[model samples]
Target: MSCNAASAAGPRIVSMNVCSDQLVLSLADPDQILGLSRCSRAAGQPGPAAKARTSPRLSGGAEDVLLLKPDLVVVSLFDKRATRDLLKAHGLSLVEFTVPRTLDEVKDQIRAMGDVLQHPQRAQADIARLDAAVAQVRAVASAHHYRVLPLERRGFVAGDSSLISSLLAATGLTNAAGELGLGAGGFASLEAIVQLRPDFILVSEAGNHAEDEGRAFLLHPALERFYPEGKRIVLPERLTVCGGVMLADALDRLTEELKRVTR
Candidate 1:
């Protein structure tokens, strides 16, 4: 379909990436979504699973999307190259988004999708709420200055270049990862993490048991003893994995978790 057709009553959209899936699901009308990526409903997929389940999950095929004749297809720069080429070959109108690294970029993305989905007001509303959430967190953070490390399995650290770091700074908390000289992000050794002595490590989950080598690393005996439940923050991967309206919820939870843990 020609791009001009999307100007009418919210385009029929197919999201080919999980991040964009979250954005589309957040801002689009139910009928406006034509399909979602196959991984859109995978474990830890952000946003509303019910809305995602209501649509067909694409199996990395562009032909089916062509048949659907969606007014727009959203993809990321990192999406499969062959599939992107195939969709381009068919001249399907497409919008591309890059992974956002800062809070402002996240807001821009939400605003962009808002226009794409014909729901600018909803996007603005979500942005306002996100701003309010940030304000709340800032209030709490101003009274407390602690370093938080957004740690992941295998000691992966979310560093200064990530959206999480931006959120941390915006709310008055510090990302301990930046202190380790990891600007974009990198892995940390157990010894390094212990030496850093962060006030808290932000984990995606609060698993006390290990299910695999990666999970095992996080639950290493030493970690369990040092960064136990009360010492670690449990912000689900779904909430922090991608930056979108979910960040509003993330910010709110950060507020509550900070209040609970510091008290």
Candidate 2:
């Protein structure tokens, strides 16, 4: 079936990816949303998760999405290729979004989503809020120079192209991964990390609790020995996973965490 442009108000929409789910819930009218991805309701998802409860959740299956008969389906580039291909074969109108690695890209995406949903004014308002929050953090961050490394599960470091790296730059902190010779992101050996000696290690969580083996790497004895307590910045996975309305909150949280560690 051929699809027409979205109506002035918007089209009936279903979001098949977790990140797309957040964007849809943030920008689309309640009446426009036909369904959201199941992961949108997962614990710790915050804003999107709360809103998702009011809508039906899909399991990212073409069959499930077909059942919704939505006028549009939004997805992430990383979403299952098979599912996306199936939807396209069935002549569904689909909008696919790439993962944003920088603040500018994030802003662009918010506006794009708004345009797709036929809510340009709402997108502008959201952009204004995001700009304001970023300015607030930038003002405080400009006064100090610190080196921060976004170390995630399994000793992987966020590269210069990652959102976390962009956030660090916006906050006036240097990304330590570059100093350690991993400009594009790669696993830093425990010994390499210890040598780099970043002023702070930005992690999704703190404390000794390791939810799994991947998490256990974050709590390794060497990491603790080098960057203990105040040196570890906890930004939470929810805020960093998606670039959407929650990004403002992520900036605020990062600014506070930076202040806490620097003090």
Please list the residue runs of candidate 2 whose C-alpha ends up more than 4 Å from where it truly belongs after superposition: 1-8
lDDT value, candidate 2, whole model: 0.85
Residue 226 of model 2: what lDDT? 81
Q: Compared with the true structure, what per-residue lDDT tens digits does model 1 show for residues 6-52?
A: 66666898999899999998899898888999898898778798999
Model 2 C-alpha lDDT per residue in residues 1-263, reported as the tens digit of each score: 23454465478899987888878888989989899887778888746555789999887689989987888899888988999999999988899899999988988999999988988888888888888877887777777777888898899999898888997887677899998778889998888888888888989887899989999998888888788888988889898788887888888888788678777
TM-score of each: 0.93, 0.92
Clashes (candidate 1): 0
lDDT score for residue 194 of model 1: 89
